[model samples]
Target: TQLLEQSPQFLSIQEGENLTVYCNSSSVFSSLQWYRQEPGEGPVLLVTVVTGGEVKKLKRLTFQFGDARKDSSLHITAAQPGDTGLYLCAGADGNKLVFGAGTILRVKS
Candidate 1:
């Protein structure tokens, strides 16, 4: 069975601080995606990494896939209160997706 593990299940930081979250897995995946979600709403896809060592950035957020395709990371720079939300990593297994437990981040203004 494929499984994804996310680190630092919860985080609280002041605005302008930076943080990095990680996702790891023993099983290889064809693709991996990152998502951010606010309370009472569905997660929104942030980025997808398909190639090993690929990196994608969205404004102050950066996503990187491990060279071996078994891990990924997300880094945020100068966080704002609006950045507070749940961050998730999902690995593609054929047509199904294996999701990490998710990391909750709260940025206080």
Candidate 2:
């Protein structure tokens, strides 16, 4: 079985501070996805990286897929308090999805 492991289980930062979280796996995936989950809402798909070495940016956030397709990272620039939430990384392997433990982010005002 393949598993995604996320680093820095928790992150607490002040508004405007930049941070980066990582997701890694031993298995290669065809595609990987990033999601953000707020307190009461289900996770919303943020981005999906299919090609290795691809980089995608959404506003102040950037998502990157590893050259080997076995790792990924999420970086936020000048983060705001509104960004506080649980960030998850999932790898799509064939018909199954393997999820990371998730990183909890708390951005203080």
RMSD of each: 0.6, 0.6
Per-residue lDDT of candidate 1, residues 27-95 (tens digit)? 899999999999999999999999999999999999999999999999999999999999999999988
* Model 2 misplaced regions, further than 4 Å: none
lDDT of 2 by residue, 1-109 (tens): 9999998899999999999999999999999999999999999999999999999999999999999999999999999999999999999988778899999999999
TM, every model: 0.98, 0.98
* C-alpha-based local distance difference test score of model 1: 0.96
Candidate 1 lands at a TM-score of 0.98
- In TM-score terms, candidate 2 sits at 0.98
Candidate 2: C-alpha lDDT:
0.96
lDDT of 1 at 26: 98
